[model samples]
Target chain A: MTETPTSSHFKENAHAALHDAPLQKALQHVRVNFIDKRAKAVARLPEFEALRDSARDIKDHTLANLDLYIEAYEARVVAAGGHVHYAMTAKDGVDIVLKLCHERGAKAVTKGKSMIAEEMGLNAALEAAGIDPIETDLGEYIIQLRGEAPSHIIAPAVHLNKEQVEADFRRVHRDLPSDRDLSQPVQLLTEARGILRDKFLSADIGVTGANFLIAETGTSIIVTNEGNGDLTQILPKVHIVLASLEKIVPTLEDASQLLRVLARSATGQDMSVYTTLSTGPRRPGDPDGPEEYHVILIDNGRSSMLGGDFEDMLRCIRCGACMNHCPIYHAVGGHAYGSVYPGPMGAVLTPSLIGVEEGGQLPNASTFCGRCEAVCPVRIPLPNMMRHWREREFERHLSPKAMRYGIGFWAFFAKRPTLYRLSTNVAMRALHWLGRAKGRFASLPFAGGWTRYRDLPAPQGATFQSQWRAKSGSVH
Target chain B: MSAREEILANIRRSLGVTGAEAPRRMAVDDRLAQARSGIIPQRGQGDQAARVATFKDEAERAQASVVEVETAADAPGEIARFLRDSNLPATLRMGDDPRLAAMPWSATALDTAHGASDGHDLNAVSAAFAAIAESGTLALVSGPDNPTTLNFLPDNHFVVVAASDIVGDYESVWRKLRGGYGKGAMPRTVNFITGPSRSADIEQTLLLGAHGPRRLHIVIVKGA
Candidate 1:
């Protein structure tokens, strides 16, 4: 199992991942699938562009008036006999959940895939309190068993191949026959089911994340391919929902707008296998739902983004479509960023949520390819967001002095035409003189990172400006 | 101050946006027209029938168990027969559908029938007013009569859908809902169910019945 990566450990892990050919191949396949399928899905819909625009507008409007909708949602939930709790931070969210567990005396927790829970680090907290928090989502459970964080947003275990998974299952489930053929997806699933069935039955509490929180009804909508979320929320005595404050949509109809695009963009499916809406807790006379329901609305740095240019980032549905299409992401993958969220959306979101001090390097990983923006269902300007973070990193003095000086020197000369031309002329002549038989630089000074990966093509004789001037026979 | 008042005050202070006046006596009937207008770009002819067809096709595509019947009276017997086949018990919680309430279900009762208000009925038989075919989703509304409990509390959930209530896509469904509920209108809750309650939470293995019903059954009532 891969160890949980820390800031100090990320560089080495990234180096290893970058060099791994099989990992690269797997990522390339995923990138093609996500981009190609999304393109096809969007092509069939004549009004897709219009729909995306409307979805973006709706989310923006909803977030701007989130206070009203949250109140409306609370009123609806209360009327439906559900309880609501507002949590101001990650710790606050965890505390609310822990309190609910304490009150219910919950011994075990079955959970659906909620990134918010991951953000709060709820599993560790729950385990510390002697309550076993079991991740019910197949991908989430696999990583949880290995004691690792999810590398990708959509497919948490995207980094792992079947062989690694087989090893994980063997290590975790010792009772299984040693000779069991675990290479096939079906066999792995069968073994997992046998073990998880007991956990589901025994769990005292169920926790889930909401895709959308309908303020009008105090209800949450959870979309999943597997049934884990339903079980996580329904079977246990106490049901706790962890959601970010920005998840609120004004009405079910609004939620519908987002749902139309979510599945098509994420998996190229008309819809996921299951989309369940939960309201409060089980009402009187109901047979099987939890007796108690608690909604822990978290505001972990989300409120700070409101009414700002970066506010559009909140519209993200965590679909992973952006990362799937991004060239930079395809090359580096999720682990390189050293954060929970990876890829284009990660590059934008992690810095905002975790602060620039921790995740400042993420934004710089991008080449501003704009593929992320093209694939984003909600149409977030990812490159612009990265630029904003870059600015923030510079202001915070988080950037290296060498990088700062280099950028500063470039900017200084670029503003002066004479100096810019002089520098370009000198650089072009030097590059031309160094150009070898193959017309590529195998090794070069000042461009170590670039040269390390592949040979840099020798500069074509003169600068573009110089060539253009000469072509026009107007060189001064 | 009460929780509502305190919450409102806190929100007012935080949002820095003045709270709009609550419209008194905003009747459902008046709002429905406004809601509908906002939802549909152009009032398409045969919207209802088209919507219903959309729902039916979506249900069929998703591999959901859908059966069409002529009348609501036929629902209990058909649903009961389905449960028997699936080996699920007949004991069911009921949603507030006037037709379902009026049905002579004692004649169709596979085991027992309980209203939405009945707290003990875990295996539920309910009715969805409409479904979206594009995504194979069933939409449910919660109200005084149609309590959300009946649909959720059960281990086996059975939904009786009217074929005429089916719609083509999520956009159309949104239009119907928006048209049904005008701006600022909030239902107690609306559920869009695609399939049975499921989770892949435990080792990425897909498991049914993690928190909600292990099974979901849909019976479509046609020409009712």
Candidate 2:
């Protein structure tokens, strides 16, 4: 399964997203539900902010000593009778997983919701290998049936309404009764539950993503509200954990610290319904569990993100808080970013993973409102990292010619204080005179992007600096 | 180079360090060895009765039903009553946990089966390893005694948690786990379940019973 990035076409994607009526209706769920729920959850926990700080420090310590931790973690996994596979690239990860399935003679594979699998494009690869990869998460199952990428990380089908899901279920589950009541969301859920239950029981392999990999005990933890991940891993003969290297934490206590903030930030729950920690496969004499446990640690591009300005990006726990609070994401939704990840975190991290040339447009999509960083469980400096990407885009000339010239013109005046004040003062006065009658510009040269959407309010007679100077002189 | 070696080398290169750096190695080792607790929330910390009360309150807040019995002997009766009240079948599936086995199931008029669920069970019961008051979560460790399948496959899950095993926060549960399983050694799976399975994937309207048990009933043994 190959993923062709349209991140370079972010403008067209976002413009199309803005006008798409169904998408606009679906995105309302995100804007209305997430913010209030997060606020209530935060209000319930008085020490939430303090926990966030602890979580951040833990990630920082882990990232700094990542090599040692990885070695320690690998040893522990081996000690527990599990194998660890390292993937230097996405293809290597997929290849390793496919090989494992072949060795086990796996024909059907059930999966938990995993963003890493999405990043690796595992479903397409599995299908190509003649392995049926069935997604068990309701949102993931909907998107999988529709043959589309996830619009949001945690809420994969956040961009679809129940009507669309009802349609998808009808289209896919042709064996089910046509007259079955499929009106409410609960009806759709019940139908999917019954259908996926069969996949869970019969699948030969189960795959899931790790929220945190504990190096102390070689444990892989998954946090989920739905029990789909639990059923996915437990019901199959082989349980394969697809995780990036940065998911590692040093100990269970460190994992606990991160867990305190993760669910609250992501879904506004005190704790997700299930926070399962799996060490190896089924232990000796265990009644039920996977027979073989394999952890495929993929580094794709995260290792290069260490010890740099973007190193803080590794601190992310994939909580989706950044996107939940992002204005740009609320406006354009996840697919508009045209990367595996979206919103503020995606803007900074996608470039490093995919390449700056293709993913550079993502950084420019943000409004720099700083809400993402404010609510981040690990306190990653998302806006600052995005600014860093913008700088790199300018340095490498990846930015458009128009944007380069515009910044250069601004820099020319910005470097000279007198010229900056003079030019701004003149331009403001001229615009004030020109817009005296209407007090806004419906159309303006070189500002079509702004005017096309909404009228640009005309500038007042003088810039803020001149007004401040006049007020200060009068006061003296 | 192998993928493992190449990936580690790239990480070391990016961080501008050799893998053998002493201080870095020491930091990692020390953290793993110490396993120090950080920022325990005060909400879950209190006297024994307060902790139990907090656990019950928090669990209910997470949408799980909590019932307290005077002793372990009364657990089966309570489970039977819950089944009858909910209009569920009088059948229960469970693993061979001693605490659950010790309960006098013969006293109740319910049919019981042993071993893990095969995804067809309507009701299942298991003994919790520990309960965290901080988030009203139950910690269940997987083994021959309490099979992991009992936690997920049943339509209704009933957990019997001893009141004495209820801890203040998650960190306390880790301390208990280390005491039981030894440091740096864990069960095959340690499940921290807060409530019945749920999902808000559809239009952000929260719904319970999305794959796991539709109802989670906790019977807290107070005196035993």
Highest DockQ scorer? 2
Reference-based lDDT, each prediction: 0.72, 0.93
Q: Summarize candidate 1's per-residue lDDT along B157-188 as a digit string, tens digits.
A: 77887777776555565566557865434343
* Model 1 spans with C-alpha error above 4 angstroms: A1-12, A176-180, A436-438, A473-476, B1-53, B65-127, B140-159, B168-191, B195-219
Measured on C-alpha atoms, candidate 2 has an lDDT of: 0.93
| Cα shift from native, residue A421, model 1 (Å) | 1.5
Q: Which ten residues in a row have the lowest lDDT in candidate 1 chain B?
A: B36-45
Q: In candidate 1, what are the lDDT values of residues A1-476, reduced to their tens digit?
A: 02232433445656777898767765765666667777887776666677688689778777666666676677777776778888766887788889888987888999988888888889989888899889877778888988888877877876666677888999989887899898776567667656776676678988999998876546688888766676566667788888888888766566767877888888675677667777766655444567787888888777767767688899999888988887767776777777778888888888777777777787887888788898788999999999999998898888889999989999999999999999999998789778946789988988998999899999876899988888889645
Model 2, residue B79: what's the lDDT? 98
Model 2: docking quality category: high
CA shift at A449, candidate 1, in angstroms? Answer: 2.5
Clash tally for model 1:
40
